[model samples]
Target: MNASYRGGPTVERILPNEEAHELLGLVTEIADGELAPRVADFETRGVFPRDLVRTLGRAGLLGLPYPEEYGGAAQPYEVYLQVLEILASRWLAVAEAVSVHTLSCYPVAAHGGDQVRKLLPDMIGGELLGAYCLSEPQGGSDAAALTTRATRDGEEYVVSGTKAWITHAGVADFYNIFCRTGEPGPRGISCLLADAGTPGIVPQQPERTMGLRSSPIAQIAFDDARVPVDRLVGAEGFGFRIAMSALDSGRLGIAACAVGLAQAALDYAVDYARQREQFGRPVIEFQGIGFLLADLATQVAAARALMLAAARLRDAGRPYSTEAAKAKLFATDTAMRVATEAVQVLGGAGYVADHPVERYFREAKVLQIVEGTNQIQRLVIARSLTR
Candidate 1:
């Protein structure tokens, strides 16, 4: 069967191949049957669903858009992103985790030496879940200012300091740790791959977040954690470039996520409007409510189109950083607006846990903040324009 979501087509996506269409169909089946049913319960309990993630990995959902030689599907970025969008429509936490996992894989996949690259099979295949450690407590938007130290000692680098706001913190099998290897500033940074079992690496208590409670987020402390020199993904002092490059792609992932979330909220609002009666007529029959839903629907479509356009640019090997930033900014802002409007449409129900709109609303805010805040996205766009 075609990947029909929630008894309707949210977006008319143009698939490049029959295979891509089939892949999306498989994803839809898994999301509907497996992920959707558990989202509410898991979120309510504030539990991390490690088994669900492993299930996704086993189904080959974890490794799309990477080379097949390393156990990835080798799908186009646009195709992979649509899969993410589909997942997000069902459950934002799962989608965000997938995106974060993909981001964590970037340094090793794109920059690692042959020795490190060999680990891609397990990483891309989903056998080893990953986390990224770039933001420290003192540095969030100012990533270059991270003070995590990785001092050279014989064949290993002794790592020390803490990484903050880490996704998949305690649950991940590996971590991509960015540390200071030389002088201050971005030029001193370097990337290192550390196993979760490494000595002196500790994941602190999970943060009680506003949303996405099912996906763990916390600070990781590394007290003289010894990382072998071979674990270095790229040359020392080139990590800033790697981090920036990875974020360019990662932002597009977040944009797609926003599109999916907005689409889901819009769908919920539209459905509610059509069924709920007020004053002897369905709520949707009123022009005020109808127009609001119409505007939200239009915005969702626009966000999806913009995100896909950026993905296509990346797939074409073109300069898509500016477009990605625009997509990330526009789509996330749209998600926030759409989700808020959905809550409005539901009236009292929207404010409570009875409706998923409230959860969507909370989750939408973080997308705008992570992968660089919307304000930072504006700066990236402005910089590109003048340059």
Candidate 2:
């Protein structure tokens, strides 16, 4: 199967150099050859593709935007996000895992001490998988209100908390756990990089989610998990800032994933319309079907453009938090719309497992909720505008 399916609309990319173009080609080739074929089976079985994570790591895709000294490709955010889009069009679960892994690495790479940063090579190289623990049962959108606590005790910080909706959960090699260390609110928070095998750390069973089952989201209970003081990322009381900063970049990753999923749904719908017939003619020839497809295609293109614009702003060191939020909001909303329309285009056939449109529809709903909810994106944008 073609990664984008039957030669979809050509998205003209503004890559930084010839090397970036070559990298994109490599990603497309790998996505088509390795990912597209196995996605359906893995998704149907709800099995995590661990080997593919290593495959992506070996391809240098897992660490695209980080510095080369730490086993990264050092690509610009624009190029890196487009690569994610390509992968997502083929396999959303794999692409989402990559995004979460990248997010997990940011706290250490950006804020940790030199000793802590040394492990980044292994993390980025795919030798070690990572997870970010932030959301608690009581705190989903209100991250500042998280109740997980980490108390300083001589050489180690004893962590105790339950983190909900954690991606990678039990399988991650390391976890960046955000917890309270001082008073209540964001100021009391600190980030700790804890090994997965640490004593007192327990990961509950994976949630039975509506989609992305292979990604393995679960609740992690850090029952006095002892983490060395040296593992603390940044200074105490700065974890909230680090988390927010990482989220700005992560939201863009989700936007790229949304665009790819929307593109996939649009492709499937177009292909089905051309092949299926009604009234002695292809369904695509009917004005109603054709117009709907046209609108979905336009939406996909517009979302891609918006996402890329945010990525470029980030790459240029501009204040792109607002732009990223807008991209996340618009692109994810577009994904939901396009997927829903794609299902309608297929009618009953789209609802079944025989086609991927239904899966796309299910997966698209979470995009609007994760990273930051669409409602939160609006608030972020409003704050930026009003400020």
Candidate 3:
């Protein structure tokens, strides 16, 4: 799945197909023209820019991997990774919302029967947005230990429980709710497609996050929410596997986002270093500062490479869990380090909003925590080592 990239130290130009390059161009254009200008307003006020998401949908960037018949681009994972990377570079909140939306759409798209897939046209066409509900207050990274309960009735499943830290919770058009259906533990879980307006389905106030403010998080409660049995995605016991598979794909998205974040930081640091004079010379002219930029750039390249490798594995229909975990682990940690160093390179200016390095710094921290922590990623990789 690994193919050598051509031209320059900017390995991000590499992709599995030319379509990715074209898609990334659109992403960059949109980011620079639409999102970059509004980032300060959104991040500072913690207000979600819902209108921006619709714009992304209109651009056909919302659903890249699904079949074209469903209004998707039918792009491969490699191409999708680049899109995520580009989006993250401009605004991480937008990039992450797209990632989480895709994650939320997967169970119904891939595993649900034809009836569910039929929804893909409107769903992927940007008419509908989605959220995934798997984490509970007590669960966090211990997803298998989820406590959300669902009881079956004659023709429907009565869902009763709260889902915590749901991205796009109140704003999403649909939710892929994972709840317990059997005895206990992982095997008891199931994925149900619950519409946002369903009776008894409630979205609480959005949580004030440390960063990624343009993307809001909230808790959802299903108080005997009546979901038709037909709404179930895959089979009852397959939810655990379904969730894991979606997360595998999701980790790739996060990895790409991390790459973009690191790229933004590096670009800022390099540009600032070249302009800001220090000791009667440009800062970049100093070997110490030059070497730091070099190292940060190198790490960013490595992060992009790892994510692309995993994305290629996904395109090949191979086991990508270990590789995806590795990519997420490496890329996110790199973003954190690179963002911190980027601020250091900018000195006092970096710490302030006159430059976006501070924003990049704040945004990079969450990449390590969401989509499963780096600690959880290592466990997934180590467990797969025995296999």
Candidate number that wins on lDDT, 2 or 3:
2
Q: Tell me the spans in candidate 2 whose CA falls farther than 4 Å from its real position.
A: 1-10
Q: What would the per-residue lDDT of candidate 1 be over residues 1-387, giving only the tens digit for each residue?
A: 111224236468799999999999999888888887888889989998889888888888788978888998999999999999989998888998899999999898899999899899999888899998999998999999999999999999999999999999999999999999999999999999999999999999999999898999999999999999999989999899999999999999999899889998888888888989999999999999999999998998899899889999999999999999999999999999999999999899889887788888999999999999999999999999898
Model 3, 1-387: lDDT tens digits are: 000101112443756666667777778778878887787778888878888988898899888998787788889988888888877887888899889888877887789898677777777766688898988998999899998888999999999999999998888999999999996888988889888999999999999777788787989989999998889899997899899889999999999999988998888788778789978999999999999989988899899889989988898998888999999999999999999998899888888877788888988999998889999999998999887
Query: What is the total number of backbone clashes in candidate 3?
Result: 0
- Tens-digit per-residue lDDT, 165-259, candidate 2: 99999999999999999999889999999999999999999999999977899999988899999999999999999999999999999999999
RMSD of each: 2.3, 1.6, 4.4
Which candidate, 1 or 3, has the higher lDDT? 1
Two-way TM-score contest, 1 vs 3, winner: 1
> Pairs clashing in candidate 2?
none
On the 0 to 100 scale, the lDDT of residue 376 in model 2 is 99
Q: What TM-score would each prediction reach against the true structure?
A: 0.98, 0.97, 0.95
